[model samples]
Target: MTEGKRAIIQQLLQEYDIQDAQDIQDALKDLLGGTIKEMMESEMDQHLGYEKSERTESEDADRNYRNGYKSKRVNSSYGSMDIDVPQDRHSSFEPKVVKKRQKDISDIDQKIISMYAKGMTTKQISETIDDIYGFEASEGFISDVTDKILPQIEEWQERPLSAVYPIVFIDAIHFSVRDDGVIRKLAAYVVLGINSDGRKEVLSLVIGENESSKYWLSVLNSLKNRGVQDILILCSDGLSGIKEAIQTAFPKTEQQRCIVHMVRNTLKYVANKDMKAFAKDLKTIYTASDEKTALSQLDRVTDKWDGQYPYAMKRWHENWDAISPIFKFSKDVRTAFYTTNAIESLNSTLRRLNRQRSVFPSSQALLKALYLATFEATKKWTSPIRNWGKVRGELSIMYPDRMPD
Candidate 1:
């Protein structure tokens, strides 16, 4: 100990009527015991037998800590703190901080979660813990810490939702995961809401096999059970049974086929040589001033292409009833519903995160990683949603009975 510190310690002890290391030690142990006793009397009754709260569970378990006189030392970033530990009732009291088998510091787990959420590999997290936190936390340890978030993710996924949405966009994207022995594709669907407050919220994520209506039926029904009483606009890229699913869950919601996906799908059928001409003609259909104008423009293009491509016009005409409603709205809202771009943006973020992970040992690990990714992604949802005012205004004029309560 430095002479200056020793002298000051002596001076303070003298003022407090003590001047020896043993006396100081005795005082601290007494103080800590009193603190614990008072705490137990005041609040421990509230959580005596049931599961202890996460913050103090470890603390409650450390009641048997032996009261020791030797100056107990714990190193911290600032340097060292020499404090006494009370061993009395050691089995009944545990401070979460510095508790036995705290395993890793809380900060180490947080750092691992942050890195893993950003798609860092387990090896990377291990190295990061050693470099940044001065501890070697293995990949499994990191996974275990992250696993704490799995139940939270499950709850979030199944949580209740608002009763109504003026606009809802549905889209699914596939991610590769190791299943059994081989890699398999798992589809994740996102439901985005255009709420009365004119903001977009990611309402839910549904994981399923393939994009069939049967799977989507479960997703839609899950939403309904969770409290989504109505939907006003259902936007999606056409998958078989999608329209049927929407009608079954929310009969009044108007469905808008994503023009972006439609345009891309249309291009697939055209020959390389015909794409240039087809693109020019198809532009007219999407740029139409109203549903009538859009249908007329589509008819002209379909009539021209019918002789060259027999089913081209028929496909557009067949889907036109489901596709053209957007043109009647104010152009801003029309543009928003013309595609499921809202969900696409979220999917893009997920893909960017997933491109980093090769495989997960278990579904819980994947869910933990996804939960972190969503947490990171949702922080960016600060901008007022696109054309929300005008969209709600127009919806008010059209669906008089459907505005959010």
Candidate 2:
């Protein structure tokens, strides 16, 4: 170390009588508190245009002057310490280092927010802060810290989206929230998209009373209002009226029904003994090389199983329009759009995070938790989806007018 720095350290050691690690910590805490106090005093002097105890004509003319100090207990990473905050006669001298009514000078707020995003309960966060920082952080304090993100969430919800999304996945995840002293179930609709540059992004997250096509229509309309001019393909499950909703919002967009969900729904009707054989036949239809071949396979499967399981084959016919769109894309594009797996994977992360809280206190609380979880889950989506180069080429050829250059 430099001689001047070494001399200052030696002076501090003698002044605080440092003997061990705990003593060093205490000395550092005192030093930090004193530093903040000095900074506030300097701020007051700067505001008043003169140093402390210095009498001048300009200072005498001005009415604002130091009015003693207020003892304020502030929390920091080192620990908690009481600092004297400088006050002004006119109450206009606001200390920029520690603003008025601000008690935290540490990064504990950000630490709490990061923990909350990882699905830690407020109480858990309180205990963690106490354990790590040697302070008693109330649950209310933790909630107050996390509540600061509400405005950010609002801005994110209303942010504009790209004019065209080559592939978008829409899905709903349900949670229990308390309303009017009673617990109610609500759905948080998640929309994920692959933009024209072939990178994945979360388009929007909306919390609704329930999963309904009526609500989904509004969600799609919100997307349109946010600058989504066209969507080449939308992948989702067979929620009733969703097809009609998509038609109303973006009629030109091709809707691709999740083939995985369709298979699961179809298997619900097949007998246990015939499930293996039935699923084998059903796979041939969806996995066919082309639309014509898929139809032939569907006809063969229908003739063999229709009499025994009529409803299973009937659903295929009913939703064939939505399911048939996948056959038009190349393998790379088909793999990306054939199912709602992209959004479903995101949903799985949300579900895991939600499991920590059995029931949220309010709809806002539910939204806050989901929004934080979504941010955490999507942190690593910096790159394009697998084989996005080939997928982009295929989409460009398929939607020549919609795809960007």
Question: Please, what is the whole-model Cα lDDT of each candidate in the order they appear?
Answer: 0.70, 0.87
Model 1, TM vs. native: 0.76
List runs of model 1 lying over 4 Å from the truth.
Answer: 1-93, 272-276, 306-314, 360-362
TM-score of 2: 0.89
Candidate 2: list runs displaced more than 4 Å: 1-12, 17-20, 53-65, 88-90, 269-278, 303-311
135, model 2: CA deviation in Å? 3.2
- Measured with C-alpha atoms, the lDDT of residue 17 in candidate 2 is 84
The sequence of per-residue lDDT tens digits that candidate 1 reaches over residues 1-405 is 999989966775765656576567555545544454445433333423332332334565544333333334443222223443333333454543355443332355666778888878788888866665444667887777787777878788888888888888888766676777777777667778877786778888766666666767788898899889988888888777888888788888888888888888888878899989998898888887887788788878887887877765565777886787887787777876888777666677777756787665555556566668778887887875777777778888888977974
Candidate 2 C-alpha lDDT tens digits along 1-405? 899999989899789988899999999999999898999888888998899989656635557777898999988988788998888888888789998888888888889998988778898899998888889999998888899999999999999898999999977788888999999888887889989877879999888775567977998999999999999999988876778889999999999989998899999998899999999999999888899999999999999998998888888998899999878876566888888777766788889766888888888877788888888888877888888888888888888878977
